[model samples]
Target chain A: MSLEIRNLHARIAANGTEILRGLDLTVEAGKVHAIMGPNGSGKSTLSKVLGGHPDYEVTEGEVLLDGVNILGMEPDVRSRAGLFLAFQYPMEIPGVSNANFLRAALQARLPEGEELEATDYYARLYEKMDMLEMDRKFTARSVNDGFSGGEKKRNEILQMLMLEPRYAILDETDSGLDIDALKIVSHGVNAMRGPERGFLVITHYQRLLDYIVPDVVHVLVGGRIEHTGGKELALELEAKGYDWIKDDIAQAVSA
Target chain B: MNATIEAPIETVSEENDSLMTTGPDFASHPEAFRARQRAAWEKFVSLPMPARTDETWRFADVKSLSIAPYTRAEVVDDGDRAALLKKSIGIVETSGRMVFANDCLLARDIYNDTLRAKGVLWLPMEQAIAEQAELIEKHFMRESGVLGSAKFAALHESQVKAGTFLYVPRGVEIALPVETFHWLSGEGASVFPHTLIIAEENAKVTLVDYFQSAGDDAGFACGVNDIVVGNGARVTYVAVQDWNRKTLAFHLNNTTVARDASALALRLNLGGSRVRDEAVSRLRGPGGRSDMLSVSAAEDDQIFDQRTLQIHEAPNTSSDLLYKNSLNDKARTIFTGLIRVDEGAHKTDAYQKVRNLLLSDEAEANSAPGLEIEADDVRCTHGATSGQVDMEEIFYLQSRGIPLRLAHQLVTFGFLNEVIERLPGEPLQQKLRELLHGKLG
Candidate 1:
């Protein structure tokens, strides 16, 4: 099984500014891939396009989870098909409690006219929450409302754990997190690592790569993956910075 | 509380022979109450019907009201009575509970004997009128219906028989809530429900009242609630007005707070084709506080007209009103609230907020929030907001695999739960939420 992107192309719907131009990538099951890029390099746009965010429109190509094209599907339909997006900025639904929100998500995964067992649901929720170091009280508190930046990141991990999507994309999940929170979040992500799941971790800084050690690394430049290599590529990019990749692309285009 | 499922609705034979001359059987009560009831009947007859020119009657569907078709509710048979009593369950454990069907007492459950031993007066209106006549006289139907429904209020005063009169003696704090249920059964029957709670100095008490219909029978419900909070007393009142979808209802409330006392009242309107709700909270003494909260779900052709007034008359007093409504289908809701800080009531803090969630293109919501501040050193704010479900919020929920319909329902519940969560009792809040979900379902 794989999350295959076949020459995916997208642009901002309101303004016809193209972001993902002829992008190609494949995140096969049982692998963690990292996409490193500089600011305005379409890193976030890629995530939003894959998640079917309404602001972005796919002009061409396809995003397939398990060989089924999800580009035309609604966001929720894609999610039910086992695609998950960990938002860069988790939304705070003011009146919905975290436990209730999680419960609704899990309930939605169930078939029509069926309900999730309450005790089983809470048991699993508390177990996953413990992994993220979240307090039990948050189960009753509003989702992400008045949460710290680190807390929001942890909550995103918590949701990813609860949903257990077949393919997950964590977009800047390590941002705004302290070193301690970063390690804890990475630990939680690592705990979910297995052959049954695939992950795409997108970040601008390589500090996150230190914890989430990807099996494959790609440098995103000018709306495309300019270079692909082993995990060592992250260390090389961190040392040389994104300017080197930009210069390489510029030189290649001129030549 | 039981879920609002398709329970077997036993229809009762209705008798429409009653007239304005018909009166409630208030035997053994003092004559003064009877005289007061007579005066109320006369007042109900003399006051002209709400007309188009009346400011309070603006935007109200005056044409749909047919009071002539509704007669005083007759007593139900034992079978229907037992069925209604079975349906009267609200919370598993309560300090006391009384169930009434068609304005007749069906069952009485008082689990706490210490409450009686501690001089807590928990009596039905019939008994309370004779036993606690002075207290009843001082507080019963004391406030005129200023926000409209004066005619309905007078009718309730003249017709109410089965009600609750709760008094918490000085410093007496009841751990659990006391509940009352009024079930209307016969078609075209009308029931008047009243609750008057008096908390003595430094006392604390919580009371919940439920209005329901035994079946899908069309009915008329007029309910009045009065909360009298004494010095340093704390009173929490909840009214769940869950009439049938075909019923027409009116719920009027008045609250008075003494020095340093605090009063909180929450009303949940779930059903009814047309409902007019009016609430007024008067902070009468220094340091007194009042919190008025309401949540309503109107769907189909339902219409909810709500008006509220918060008057801060003394310095250092505060009053807050939050009313939320979710309108769907062709539902219509009107919310008008005024927060008034009287002169010399310096340091007053008053707030009035009304939020309407429109769930349909055809649904209409009108909101008017006003503030009158004659005092200088007071902080007062009032606002009314009408908005559809936030797309981003719904998208957030939908991205987690929740269907669009479920996501809309979740966000709507989230919108109204803000007021439901304000309640102090956990069981009642859970019951309210469950009932709310059932209604939506």
Candidate 2:
């Protein structure tokens, strides 16, 4: 019913420097929740930790996807468990065509000895590609190789649309998009906003919030959510900046 | 059947003399074949083992050149023949196929009757010597082994009896490829398989040679292949060597390109305990081009040694070489290639590149690339690189829910496919890819 993280604490594996001290968040189905934070506020670390990346070690955390603990799962296991992370910097895999890569992923989901239907796969792929306004030839081209900045983000959305995971974490998906690409990507995400799926949008700037408006906006500082408010909080934070919250959090910690 | 026969007979001496005297009559008769065999034996014995200091044998295990333990094997029994034939299957849509076991032909499948009627010669080497004696003599082993396997070359010529002889007349273009399979049978057995191709002016053809073992028995194989490309002709040659894990193999190949002719040769090495390959391409006329490519998958205790030379001997000629290797476990691979542009070969363009993908900490790869240019207004470049699998590439595949083993397989396939995709024939490429996939499995 929801992706709930309770008292999540993570640290760097190399130095053991704690990044996420105690983070708590909940994203329910049929709604988009946005996390807006300042630089060094551990926004990217939270996304990495949620995705089960090996670099970020979870010292103490409980991540529940539909009441199932996902903290002990591997990164790929998390993916198979209906958790999808749209990497901020999507990797470019040379020599692996987009169609083949997507087919392999879909094939992994099928039972042994049961082959994927090629006709149906291509039809669905073309439909999803059309929805994202991508050229048909992109399927035959290498995955994200030689793609422009906007094209890479669009490719991430294309994968999200195809996989159709229960929960999706868009990690700064709007950082490099132009106005036109932003509109197209937001349209793609909007079409998938339904009761069966939940989204957690992480961003440093509030510009993306203007297009894909979130129902709830949270201010993240030093790994934990310090303030929660309605959608207007994004506009206020954009105008007032994160300095006020950093000062208030410092005083509270000192006290 | 004749196990009591003496190891050496008086017939061997007469065979040696016949081989040394090359003439038209020698080209046609079985006596010439015996003489060539005798001469090859003497030459193989007289030539000393390659030393470590020898430039061509650098980074090689010279001691692995032992040939005394292996004796030539006879045909296999009927019971084991069927299994060997089944394993020899390659390219389902080939125009013709010839399968050989222990220097003996087991089966011949010539599907294209029109090509046969058009005077396109496709037969075994011995058969061709009898039927197309003049043609076989004109092009058989016409070039010397300049890549530094002259000793093995002599051994191959001495014992060569069964192989493919393909000749396409002028203006004839065979639409499908011709395949030849050579399989080693008994323990400590040795087989010499030869392939001679002559594409006349304006003719085009493709030939594939597959070397494999009947079982897990230890064996040795010394193969020689020579291809002649006439004016305005195009020829493609592919060799896939998949001997048993305990087998030692040596394959020597030479290609001669004439005016406006192009030749492409690709070798895929998958098996064998120790394998040494020497390939040379001579661009002999203007507008001629040669593409020399190879892919090696060395695993366990396998060792692969490869040497190549591209000689641009004519004006406006070109040559390009790309060799790739993926080493695993305690495998080792050594590649040395050179591009030489002779004087007066102006406007020549030559390139040589070697890339090694190391998959294990214990695996080692050594590469040496050189260029010698004496021609004015020519372009030549040679380079060699050795590196492990890109961590980011592996992580990228792993992030997509693929397991570590499958990820490695994908990366290795992709690394080798770069060379395979450049090949001109689709059926040959597919067969090679399937063989590589089977080896990986």
Candidate 3:
């Protein structure tokens, strides 16, 4: 089982600016695949399109999550179908406590007429919060409202752990975290790795890959995966920036 | 120690069908009160209805203010009384509670003995008029109407006969809140409910007023409540207004704060066809503070018009007002608030803020915030914001698997709960949250 995207073409719905053009990749089950790209390389747009954001229209593409096409599905439907996206800039929901927000997300997964057991839900939530070193008061606080940068990132990871989706897309989860926060956040992500789940960890820095080592790394250029290699490619990219990859794509296109 | 006796209250005679007629029951009251009622009724008749050209009636549906279709509410039958009593549950525990249905007292219970031993006067308005005539005469309806509801306030003064009267003596602090439920039932029924609270020096107390209807019937409700906060005293007053969608209503309020005293007044408007609420807070002594807050949800052709004035008459006094409204499905809301600082009232700090969340394209919200400061060194800030719910917030929730409808509700509740959380007590906040949840659901 895997999440396979074939020749995906997308553009901004408002301005018709193409962001994802002829993109392709596969995240197989039991693997952590890292997609490293430069700025404006459609990393965030890819996550948003995969999550079926209304602002982006998929002109041509078929995103199959375990043989089920999710392009036509709504964002919430995609999430409930075992596809999770950890946003780069998590939103602050004023007045809705984090506990209540997470509970609602979990509650939507239940069948009709079946209720989520509150005791069990809280128990699991507290356990995951403990792993992320979150204070008990955060459960009562509004979702990410007035939170520090590091705290918001931790909250995103905490949610990813609680949801436990089959295929998780973490879009720049390491952007705002400090060293201590990075280690803690990486620990939470590493704990979720197993044989049954797949992860598409999108990051620009090699520092994140050093902690949660990727099984495979792909260099993305011009909205497409230009090259694929072992995890060492992350170190190589860090030593020599994305210029080499962009030049390599230029030469290939000229040929 | 003074003892209060149950006095027999005469219901408004049915034969006197017109609301303008002063029936025999009006004559039965004490001469001083009867004189005041006679004068008020005369004033109510002399004053013309609010017109569209009037400044106070701006942005309001003046046509909906007609009271000709409503008459005095008749006493309810046994079945409706039983049902209303059963539904009067607001908070699980209270120091005391009184239930009234259709202007008739259904039940009352006092749960605290220490407060009574300390000379706390908690009685129905009718009984309080009989037992503490001098106290009731001096403080009842003392403030003149100034927030565009003078005619309606005069009408209420002429017709109101039942409500709650609370007095806390000096240095007394009642830990639990006192509650009163006012339920109106039947078609074309009208009820005039009143609440008067007085807290002496260094006293502390909380009171909640519940205005609800027994069923979905077309009716009219005109209510007036006034509070006097003595020196260094603290008072919290909450009014929960939930009438049937087919009913038109008015709630007029006034508060006077003394030196070093603080007052908080919060109103939640959840139901009504067309409702006009006017609240005026006067800080007459130095170091006084008042917090005026309101949250309303208007949907399905409902109209909620709110007018407020914060008058700072003393130096170093402060008043803060915050109002939030959520409108959906052709609903409309109008908010006009003014902060006035009189001459020589230096160092006065006042703030006013109004926020409206429009959920549908057809919904409308109009806001006007004004400031008139005659004193130098006074600080006053006022603003009003009208906008739709943030779409990014909804996307964030949807990314976590929450459905669109639930996401909208969560955001709306969060917007309104910001004011609810400013309240003092936890139990009271919980109860208000439950009521807000029911409305949102």
Chain B, per-candidate TM-score:
0.94, 0.93, 0.95
lDDT of each: 0.87, 0.85, 0.89
Candidates ranked, most accurate by TM-score first: 3, 1, 2
Each prediction's number of clashing residue pairs: 0, 2, 0
Best prediction by DockQ: 3
Which one wins on lDDT?
A: 3
| The candidate that achieves the highest TM-score relative to the unseen native structure | 3
List fnat, each candidate: 0.72, 0.33, 0.80
Q: Could you tell me how far off, in angstroms, the CA of residue B117 lies in candidate 3 after the best superposition?
A: 4.4
lDDT of 1 at B76: 91
Candidate 2 per-residue C-alpha lDDT over A77-151 given as tens digits, one digit per residue, 9 for 90 to 100? 787788888888888776567887788777767888999999999999999889889999898677788999999
When summed lDDT is taken over every stretch of 10 residues in candidate 1 chain B, the lowest stretch is: B1-10
The C-alpha stretches of model 1 lying farther than 4 A from their native spots are B1-29
| Span of ten consecutive residues with least summed lDDT in model 2 chain B | B18-27
lDDT of 2 by residue, B1-441 (tens): 333322452333332333222211123346655676567667765776788899999999888877656766766988777887887788878788899988778899888764574878888987886677577667777665667788778767766667999889998998888889998998878888889999999999999998999888889898989999999999999999999998999999989999999999999999899999999999999999999999999999899999999999999999999999999999999988888899999999999999999899999999999988898999888888888777566655655666567777777877887788789866777788788889875
* Tens digits of lDDT, candidate 3, A148-242: 99999999999999888999999999998899999999999999999889999999999999899999998877788888999999999999999
What CAPRI-style quality would you assign to candidate 3?
high
